[model samples]
Target: MLNFVDWLASTSGSIALRESLYMYPWIESAHVLFIAIFFGTLLFVDLRLTGYGFKNLSISQMNSKILPLTIIGFILMITTGLLLFYALPIRNYHNLFFRIKLFLMLLAGLNAWHFHRTMNRQGKAWDKNSFIPFWMKASATISLVLWGLVIISGRMIAYNWFDCDKQPQSELVNFLISCTVDPEIYEYLNGI
Candidate 1:
């Protein structure tokens, strides 16, 4: 998979986008904008679930009104994110924060899946009530935390603090991040 993605990363389109002076910034800006949009819309639903804000708006009404924006935001966010990754695959592939972000996204997705399933099954019963169940609120809280962590992790990807080429990493870190390199190259680069 890495080999295939490496090949794709080396393609002309990816290289062009990555090497372009202005295009990368524009794509990154779009990615950030969509992330804000998606998370902003999600905030309404989460707050509604927690019964802390949007109390006047019923769950069904909130879902009906805000779901479209949320979906659009999510779709665009994913599209921009993929384009960003396509531009630079190998660096992001070995990034610790990228791995962390992906894991958090998976957990967040599962939480969302369970939340949606339960909400769909029992939403009519309590959709109008200002008082929500503890489990639903808990789930929403978890979603907020996980997504926040995901964003932080994603942002951390730009930092090279733990880059694979940086030595003095533990054996486990090397294994986890595939930091192995030719000994001569390592020593020459590090002047060790």
Candidate 2:
């Protein structure tokens, strides 16, 4: 896995991104913009599921109105995120925060899948009820927490404190970063 990631990091696409003055920033900006849109729409629906707002609208109605926009924003966010990751595959693969963010994203996806499969199985039956199912409220709350963690972890990846390049010369740090310690790269990093 490390070898494959290292090779990907050295590929022409990654090299071009590193060399291009604007490509990386543009992709990053797009990723952030789409994230806002995606999360915004998702939050609205999740809030409704929690019976906190949008009481006038049926759950099915709100979901029908907002889910499409959320899906579109998600598609755009994922596309741009992949491009950003390809730009610095190794650095991202080694970043702890990135790992955490990915894990949380997976959990969030699973939570949504479960909620849809179960709570939404009955269709519009509960859509007009004043009180949402406890399970649905729990799912919404969990989704919010998971996404919040993902966002925080994603933002922390930009800080140099735990970045591979700034890691201390310790075995734990080396192992965490999956540092191959290739002589060429090590020497290059060391200003050889």
Candidate 3:
């Protein structure tokens, strides 16, 4: 699996992205911008759901108004994020912060899924009520925390503090990330 990832990382598309003077930075900027839009909209909706703010609009109405923008932002973010990942698949796949970000993202997705499945099924029963159910509030809180952590982890990926290449080879970081470092890639990174 690691070998295949390394191979993909070395592909033409990846190489092109790495070699391009502006493509990588532009894509990264897009990723960050989209993330801001996505998370910002999400925060508003979640805050309304938790009865913290946006009390003027009902929960259903708030969701309806903001969900489209959130989806759009999410789509754009994912697209740019994938391109960025392709540019250095092996480095990202082995990074602890990247792994944590992925995990948090998965949790956030599941939380959203569960919220939609359960709370949304109740129609407008609690939509107009400022006092949302405990479960809904908990879900909203969890989403906020998970998304915040995801952003932090994503930012940490650019730092070499805990990067795989900077760690001791014998450390268990590889096993934790579920990927081994390719020798050539290791040597290349070390030589830099």
Top candidate, metric TM-score: 1
Clashing pairs in 2: none
lDDT-better candidate, 1 vs 2: 1
Comparison by lDDT, 1 against 3, better one:
1
Cα lDDT tens digits for candidate 3, 1-192? 788888998799999998899999999999999999999999998998877677888888888999899999999999999999899898888788898899999999999999998876684688545467788789999999999999999999887565566654533665776645765755665677
TM-score of each: 0.91, 0.86, 0.87
- Candidate 2's TM-score: 0.86
Give the higher-TM-score candidate: 1 or 3.
Answer: 1
Give one digit per residue, the lDDT tens place, for model 2 in 1-192. 888888998899999997899999999998999989998888999999888678788888888999999999999999998888899888899887888799899999999899889766665668645566787789999998898888898999887566667634455566666665545654565673
How many clashes (backbone N, Cα, C below 3 Å) per candidate? 0, 0, 0
lDDT of 3: 0.85
Query: Candidate 1, residues 5-72: lDDT per residue as tens digits?
Result: 79989899999989999999999999999999999998888887887677678888888889899999
Alpha-carbon lDDT of model 2: 0.83
At residue 74, candidate 3 shows an lDDT of 93
Query: In candidate 1, which residue pairs get closer than 3 Å at backbone N, Cα or C atoms, i.e. clash?
Result: none
Clashes of 1: 0
lDDT scores of the candidates, listed in order: 0.86, 0.83, 0.85
